[model samples]
Target: MKKTVLVFGLLILALLLMFQFSKYAVISGDLKVELIVASIAIVFFFIGVYINKKTLQKPNTPIEEISHKRIKELDISNREYEVLQKIAEGLSNKEIAQSLFLSESTIKTHVSNLLVKLDAKRRTQAVKKAKSFQIL
Candidate 1:
């Protein structure tokens, strides 16, 4: 914690120094317009980086783009498919059970079976794979 505070303090001090130096340089005409342009370019570079990161975080796969071959090959049961749809809708086991008129344990079993069929270790992963396969 102390190390973190120390580092942050140093960074703050450096920024203050840079700001004062830049103010002096600009007033003295020591900083050129080229430097201003370069700073703008750097700001835009960081903005582009942030936008690219956000874009990459979201998948762009449309439903029409998802292949159906693996979906057909998986041959999931009708009930399992229903459970998968509920999972895709972001329902919890208890909610799914209530909606489907089944016990929570039964819903859990179906979720487990669906995971095995989809070869996924987590519920979210199973749903993503199912969507990618156009099964949901």
Candidate 2:
């Protein structure tokens, strides 16, 4: 979604530049005025982007807060943390079982246990929460 927006934004900017600069070659009049205006506008645009980045640079740790909250919220087991590590590495239950030498049914049980203990509706949510709590 962001890529589409970025591509469209660049297209609009290119079109606008063509309209402004192309006027000079055909108009047969003083192009100095147009050049000056465009140059100043571009400089101001860059400066505004610089200032905006600086304004958004405050540092904080949301992960630590989530760890505290999750310790109270989650009821994880030893196997659940193992399941989370596998999920974080983008493993399916069968693949995790293959690595752990467990049966597919056992892996499914551990996954279900992880989901309930972490108060997650799904495996993806459980993995995300585990990362948030630094448990995986």
Candidate 3:
């Protein structure tokens, strides 16, 4: 955070200096108004490009492969796995039922089974265990 603040502070200071220099040049008639404006615009364009490059950079992370063998070993059925994925997405039982076109009670049963298979006490813990097992 401190490093970001410092970098931004320096950029602002440089921009202020450039503006002051342009103002002085205009007042003294040492530079043409059009030339000054063009130079400032060019500087601003480069600054925008720099900021975009810095802020829009995505981290390179390896994609994790789901373990089908682990899922089979855990005895989680396809429908139960689907319900588990929905639960991992933070969906409610009613929402999961609606999305899957199943009854809410059925969704609840799948969740219960997932909890037992994952040996988890809660939905979040079940999801965490599933990820740790590479089944999610």
Candidate with the greatest TM-score versus the true structure: 3
Model 1 Cα RMSD, Å? 8.6
Model 3 C-alpha lDDT per residue in residues 29-73, reported as the tens digit of each score = 999989988998898899889989998999998989999999999
| lDDT of candidate 1 over 1-136, digit per residue (tens) | 7965875586568567666766777889989767855775675576568657865796776547544566568977778888898999999999999999999999999999999999999999998888777666
Q: What's the C-alpha lDDT at position 96 in model 1?
A: 96
Q: Which one wins on lDDT?
A: 3
Pairs clashing within candidate 1: none
Candidates ranked, most accurate by lDDT first: 3, 1, 2
Query: Which scores greater on TM-score, model 2 or model 3?
Result: 3
Stretches of candidate 2 exceeding 4 Å from the true structure: 1-73
lDDT of each: 0.80, 0.74, 0.94
Model 2 scores what on Cα lDDT? Answer: 0.74
**Residue 88 lDDT, candidate 2, scale 0-100:** 82
Candidate 3, residue 27: CA error in Å?
3.2
Return the TM-score for candidate 3, rounded to 2 decimals.
0.87
